[model samples]
Target: MSTLIVPKLDEQPWPTLGPQIAAFIEERAIFGPGSLKGQPARLDADKKAALYRLYEVYPQGHPLQGRRRFKRGSISWRKGLAKTEFMAWVAFAELHPEGPVRCDGFDAHGRPVGRPVNDPYIPMLAVTAEQVEELAYGALSVMCAEGPDAEFFDVSLERIIRLDEYGRADGKAVPLSNNPGARDGARTTFQCFDEPHRLYLPRAKSAHETMVANLEKRVLEDPWGLYVGTAGELGQESIAEGIHEEALAIDRGEIDDPQLFHFHREAGGTYDMSQREQVIEAVREATGPVGEYGPGQFESIAKQWERPSADKAMLERLWLNRWVRSGQQAFDPNAWANNGLPGSIPDGALVTAGFDGARYRDSTAIVITEVSSGRQELWALWERPADVDEWELPLDELRESMAYLFEVMDVWRLYCDPFFLEETVAAWQGRWPKKVYEWRTNVASTVVHAVRAYREAIASGEVHWSQGDPQAADLARHIGAAGRRRTNFVDDDGQPMFMLQKIHPDRKFDAAMAGLLSWEARRDAISSGVTRSRSSKMLVF
Candidate 1:
């Protein structure tokens, strides 16, 4: 409400079952896992409006008509809001026999109708066991154990089983602190996390992602996930923050993620926390009716801000719901996004190319840059398919792509990693001579300066790509995943040196590595006075 920093989805055109889902929640779920323990649940105006967007479905004539729009989403708000209680409402709807959650078909009026996910598997995950008991799992258990729907479910402290007609368990909502894969291969239809901001541990992250990977198994169920949390601590690289970055990219229009819905609301502008009125007003905007500033409310959350040891940054993150940047990221996602210059390098353009190859367990990529303008494009990338076990780089097709590039354009240089591409690089060098040179990243002694210069190029917009290009998303993802690694070394410029490495071990950045090498090749082309004319030779290794 306070000038929504990241706005919610539009309110009009209730072309979704979101409203129906909201109705189902208000009628079925209860108000408290906290203060109003046995009260009938009432979703406030703000909370009710969110369901409309979150439950949008694809319309007729669309590729997957009548299917729900979002496959995953995040809702970020200030502290003290009943986010876990809201998630519990959704969890009930996900598994309740009569709850309208999955899109069934169109109504006569052309709007989407909904049905419950069949045999739904819902996992409520948290960072620790105490947190598991303290959050959404707790809220859900209270709802099932104490609410009107209590007879429909067999509830326990850790699990809720929806009873079938014969009084047997038909669906389950389980609480897990580790990977759900270990349980029953994780057929996660609709999973919820209380606060991914606190889930920075490697084990928790890995576990949650396993459930995500398992979402595809129940494709007919229209599987999805809802993560509700606030801003994360800086430098932690929390899951919420990662999704927050993805949300920002979606907002910027630099990338498209059609199946993701992220709602981030925070009060805008700075405030003097010492001014009681100003602080209360900001809190009021963030909390709305839940602000508790009125008389007889008894419990005031604002006292925490006045504590002597209160950290202003922590206060801004938790209370104001502001995003804080991490220092470990090698490139700023915003800057990289802004550099979407819009157009691919044309045929017959003078170019410098970089090739980074891996035989297996990673991606092999080639990126090319137009020398005259520094515009870059992903030429090709070979990645291992998950379903394929006996996979390797398609050398035959790779050679065809390489040969065709030289056939169509004036390639100034190809700085290639000769690791798995040793035979290919040798053949390329034999044919192109001075045009091909080996760039081994592991030899940090020489390539560190080149790496530093390429980083500078991206920062200053010396290199850019078209947002409209099909490869922009891949490039953006690789760029975002890249992190600065300490080299315990220095470059020729007498500054500390670093290398770009994957922030998550599970993520790959071969395309970004190829782009860096491409820019470095262009730098040396300029230094050696290489021209577009074929009469001159490039820098030889």
Candidate 2:
């Protein structure tokens, strides 16, 4: 393997807490029940580097001294890399009397150490109770089973309590499921969110959001937490991906929140799985020391690849830790990623706007396309608030945004999907009779062609977008979440047609539909010879 492809750490001052933690792990912890069972838990170079970065404390004269540097962090690696084992060790360290202390200074060997907090409570949380039992509790239980560490800590299936008789410095580690009652009074000093990619489901998402919100309330008491997981399949909208995006934003200097430390180790990009050597190399890079701990990972991957009933996309996501689209995805996510540029349409440029509105369950979005350059922009998007039950669309705000778009840009055509916005569309059509049109997306014939044409534009690199726009990012997600659904009906030429449908019922695809409508309107305007300087007078109302 080439060392050039590996990630390099940035320069930082001295006094990192990694060495002390490493010493504790090597001395106290043992390998779980696997190929390396009973062996001392020792980290490799990559993992050790990640640990040092995660526990790095600012220098004494720095502005944020004496504070836990990273309030939230993540370790995204491939499967079978002992991610759960690492998390289990960290959980033990957190609950122990000497874990997670405020750094005072460095020792003779330049090892950072500090004083522990009083009354520490660390929780290992997961989306499902079964997963909590298997990944978090299972690993910790094995580590603290029959060793010197087991005598010092009372390890049980439910929780581990420190047996030390210290002065008001008691601590414990507990396994927590996705329940309001379990997370009710968790004033956590350190918390671990294991396998957060499973939170992509709706029910899991609800629990995960509530748990994270509750955890954030106690940040003042304990600002240190870890989000550890592998890369999820595309369109899942995993909370892990959300944190990963935030870390990328911070790294690019797009946002200024420095308390989030992200350590991601995956294959550089997509690999041609057809080539055996390429697949092996990618898997080897992703699974650092899995062979030493749990052999047969590569063999298992090869078996899965050769199996007739295996899902290739899912295997790529699980084994390679790459974000891959579903098998039925309507568009290639990589092609969409390539078309993102770093500019937006100039103000007052001729444009076509598309509006997609939903009432209670889904989202409402506006997508605008520049007539000349084929550049698409996400104008606005609104989703139902999680706290409300009977949430309604903010039509007034939508109307105001629409008016602002019309006033600022010379809109050639405004196509509105008249789903729950019949009245709004009618008003707009009356106001801008020459420009506004009620576009019905429910018609199979229109939708089939529109979806085909829009995807073709994206595939051909004709659709350009502003890079790093959060709304655009959301659009890409929604597009990825859409699956191609073929209909029984055929076109005039006897060719089968299809439409893009949501992969999951709760996941929204309104933004993608709005983009399609915008592209359709832009095409129509171009065919009708509509130019930027077309001086058509509107009647004053």
Q: How many residue pairs clash in each candidate?
A: 0, 0
Name the 10 consecutive residues with the lowest summed lDDT in model 1.
1-10
The lDDT for every candidate, in the order shown, is 0.77, 0.73
Give the runs in model 1 whose Cα sits over 4 Å from its true position.
1-20, 28-30, 33-40, 44-82, 92-123, 141-176, 179-192, 196-227, 230-325, 340-346, 386-389, 466-470, 491-495, 531-541
> What does candidate 1 score on TM?
0.66
Per-residue accuracy of model 1 over 1-541 as CA lDDT, tens digit each: 2433233355555378878888888888887566688888888766776677788787877888888778887888887677877888888888798899888888788978888778888988898777887788888888888888888899887688999888998899988886645754877789887899988888888887787887788898989999998878645768887787666656656455456777777765456678766776666666655556357232244566678887766776787776653455677665677687766787887899999868866788889988878888888888764335677888899999999999887898899988977988999999999889998988877666777777788788778886557877778767766777778787556777888776755456888889888988988777777646443333333
Q: Tell me how far the alpha carbon of residue 502 in candidate 1 is from the true structure, in angstroms, after superposition.
A: 1.4
Winning candidate number (lDDT): 1
Return the clash pairs for model 2, or none.
Answer: none
Model 1 residue 194 CA deviation in Å: 2.8
